[model samples]
Target: MSRAFTREVDDAPPPPILERAISSARNLVTPNGARQIEQAMETLDRQIEASGDSEALAALRRELRYWHARHARMEIVEPPEAPTIVTFGTHVTIKRGGEPKHLHIVGEDEADPAVGTIAWTSPLARALEGARPGDVVEFQAGGREEEILVLSVKGASQ
Candidate 1:
């Protein structure tokens, strides 16, 4: 039982959605996510040791674990607070190309462009950040420049 458990842990890739979320979270330096990754690594390490795996498996696990740990340590600065200006975690309403929309400027990990959660590093987010209500912003993407007008900026809580 222990051997099988070990082998399974050794062979398993990090959960895909978790990895994507973690990768995105890493880009923003979310302390909570970093801690979660550390805890997960510790769990994986114990499993690998108990499995008594071959040297190759051990090495692979070690490398993957190290990569996750190193990535968690990358610096991610928090977005500045601008109640009136759009920033990370801020919910902004805008009119883009004649369509009205609401978007949340979030960390890379939390970005879901399809659902209007944009990463702070994305061109749209970068262009929108620091903008206040009534401000007009022009962003160029895919070889074309698009214009948007900030209609409102509010905290995530609201």
Candidate 2:
């Protein structure tokens, strides 16, 4: 084939897929959150070592990159010196419609609502940040506004 008919670029493999958005920007994290990031890196490293499948290794590497970036810029913030209200790394129990619900306000990467944790940047958490026990906070959910009564506060998570 002539030079004009052949292309060198076609011989090269496509670039690896990456989730770069996950690795951008630093964020405040709790000690546990920082630990979680470290744990994730460790887990990915082990998986990458043990996996023989190319696809699995690629996925693990992508996860490792995310965790590495997270760990690199993670800023660990201590819990409130004196706990009088809700803040990052603390669990706040609140009641809506007399039904109690507990939410752990944590770093963005540690948020898992199924386990009762929410990111501090979430709307509900933002509204509840400066509130104390017995304080009522108005939160919007599903396009509707509701009131939540703070029942208690759990000490910061380790």
Candidate 3:
């Protein structure tokens, strides 16, 4: 049977860098991995069908199918437009105590603070969003008040 498809948020745009990351992840899945997952699903389906005994197993199958469909839908969704504010997919440069730092604002799935990419939900990102160049933003981090001045904002790109 063909799977039924629906989106939870029809109008929501995907996070740009996140979409790219997801695409990369999907691409990285080897043929063997795909075959393995398919094999597992088929086995599970067969067991569930034969048993006619486990609602939990059937529910698990439904959840797995839902996630698979959601992932596929996300792959096709257009990314959010680059925002003037410090939103996901924005590259922001800032200065703190005369030291310059750069951060790529991305979704939680793509956050990598070691490389300076931070999630938009982070305290620093929250404080920096909507701030223009030269605007100082203060937030508590590591139990101390940290201040950063926005130096620039642009879309994440080469």
Candidate 4:
């Protein structure tokens, strides 16, 4: 075939994978959150070993690096033996607009708002910190401030 009529194939390698961004804030983790990170790292190790594709391996390695860094920096904050006030690793019940809402203050990795769990660093959790039963916390929601009455506080169970 004439060189002008034939198209050449490009064999360039895939671009380098970007590393996952690690949070700069203190890595506070509950017991359960620590366990979760361990589990994730274990799973990623297995996947990285099994991954055959270069691109896939790169992505998996990036994920593994993130998990490793998190595990290394994690500071386990155990729930208080007898929690009397809202704090990290505690379960808090608040009344907003006469409706009861339950929330678990946990580590950033373990937060799931749908299940009523929020990160200890979240605005609501911060506002509730050091509060006891019968205390009202002012929270900003949707650009408005509202009062949330603390109904109860207890150590979070695994």
Q: Once model 1 is optimally superposed onto the true structure by TM-score, how far is the C-alpha of residue 125 displaced, in angstroms? A: 0.5
Residue-level lDDT of model 3, residues 49-93, one tens digit each, is 666545656565664564354334332212235556665566789
Runs of candidate 1 with Cα error greater than 4 angstroms are 1-26, 29-67, 74-82
Q: In order, what is each prediction's RMSD in angstroms? A: 9.4, 3.5, 15.2, 3.0
Q: Compared to the true structure, candidate 4 yields what TM-score?
A: 0.87
All candidates: TM-score: 0.57, 0.81, 0.49, 0.87
Measured with C-alpha atoms, the lDDT of residue 88 in candidate 2 is 83
Winner on lDDT between 3 and 4 is: 4
> lDDT per residue, candidate 4, 1-158, as tens digits?
66787545444565688888888889999999999999999999999889898888888989989999999999999888679999898988999988999999999988999999999998889999999999988999999999999999887442
Point out the higher-scoring one by lDDT: 2 or 4: 4
Question: How much lDDT does each candidate structure score?
Answer: 0.70, 0.84, 0.61, 0.90
lDDT accuracy of residue 55 in candidate 3: 60
The best-first sequence of candidates by TM-score reads 4, 2, 1, 3
- How far does residue 60 in candidate 3 sit from its true spot (Å)? 15
The weakest ten consecutive residues by lDDT in model 2 span 17-26
Better of 1 and 2 by TM-score: 2
Find the number of clashing residue pairs for candidate 3.
Answer: 0
TM-score of candidate 2 to 2 decimals: 0.81
TM-score of 3: 0.49
